[model samples]
Target: MSINQIQDEIIDEFSLFSDWMEKYEYIIDLGKHLPLIDEQYKDEEHLIKGCQSRVWLHAGLEGDKVVFTADSDAVITKGIIALLVRVLSNQPAEEVAQSELYFIDKIGLKEHLSPTRSNGLVSMVKQMKLYGLALHAKS
Candidate 1:
C-alpha cells in the first residue's frame, strides 16, 4: 500500500482504543512484532544520534524502492520505529523522502510522548528521509 493508505490504516487502528493506556499497549504490541534488523547493521554507523534510547536504522534500495529495517533498546521507541517502518519501508525513494507523516499528529502520538521521545521521533523521521534521499541519488 501507499504511505497515506498505511497511515490511514494505523489511524483507524489507534482509534479503536478508548484510552491512552490502551494505545500504549497497542504500540508496545506493534514493537513486539517489528521485524528484526540484521545484526551487521547494529553498529555505531546505523545508530540514530538524537534518540535518548539506542535505535539502529538501516535502509537499502531494492529496485526503485527503499527498504528500512530497524531496532531499538526501548520498547516504546521500538514501536514508534515499527510504525514508521510500516509506513515508509518498501516505497519509492523519492516518495519516501517527500512523504508527509501526518499520522504522528493525527493519532496524537507526538503529543503523548515524553519530550525526549518526541525529539527521537523527529530524528527517526529525519534519518529515514535522509536514507531515501541518499538512495534516490544513487539510483
Candidate 2:
C-alpha cells in the first residue's frame, strides 16, 4: 500500500483507543510484532542519535525501493520505529524522503510523548529520510 494509505490505517487503529494509555499499550503490542533486525546491522553506524534510548535503524535499496530494518533497546522506541517502517519501508526512495507522515500529529503522538522521546522520534524520521536521500542518489 502507499505510505499515505498505511498511515491512514495507523490513524484508524490509534483512533480506536479513547485514551493515551490504551494507545500506548497498542504501540507496545505493535513493537512486539516488529521483525527482528539482523545482528550484523546492529552496529554503531546504524544507531540513531538524539534518542534517549538506543534505536538502531538501517536502510538499503532493493530494486527501486528502500527497505528499513530497525531495533531499539526500549519497547516504546521500538514501537515508534515500527510505525515509521510500516509507512516508509519498501517504498521508492524519493517517495519515502518526501513523505510527511501526518499520522504522527493526527494521532497526537508527539504531544503525548515526553520531550526526549519526541526528539528521538524526530531523529528517527531524519535518519530515515537521510537513508532515502542516499538511496535516491544512488538510483
Pairs that clash in candidate 1? none
Clashes of 2: 0
For candidate 1, write residues 1-139 as lDDT tens digits.
9999999999998889899999889889878886659999999988876546777888989999999999887788788888889999999999998999899888888753445554366677888899899899998
Model 2 stretches astray by more than 4 angstroms: 112-119
lDDT of 1 at 92: 97
**In the order shown, what is each candidate's alpha-carbon RMSD?**
1.9, 1.9
lDDT of 2: 0.83
Error of 1 at 43 (Å): 0.8
Error of 1 at 138 (Å): 1.4
TM-score of each: 0.91, 0.90
lDDT by residue for model 2 over 1-139, one digit each (tens)? 9999999999998888999899899889878887759989888888775546777888989999999999887787788788888899999999998888788889887753445554466777888898898899999
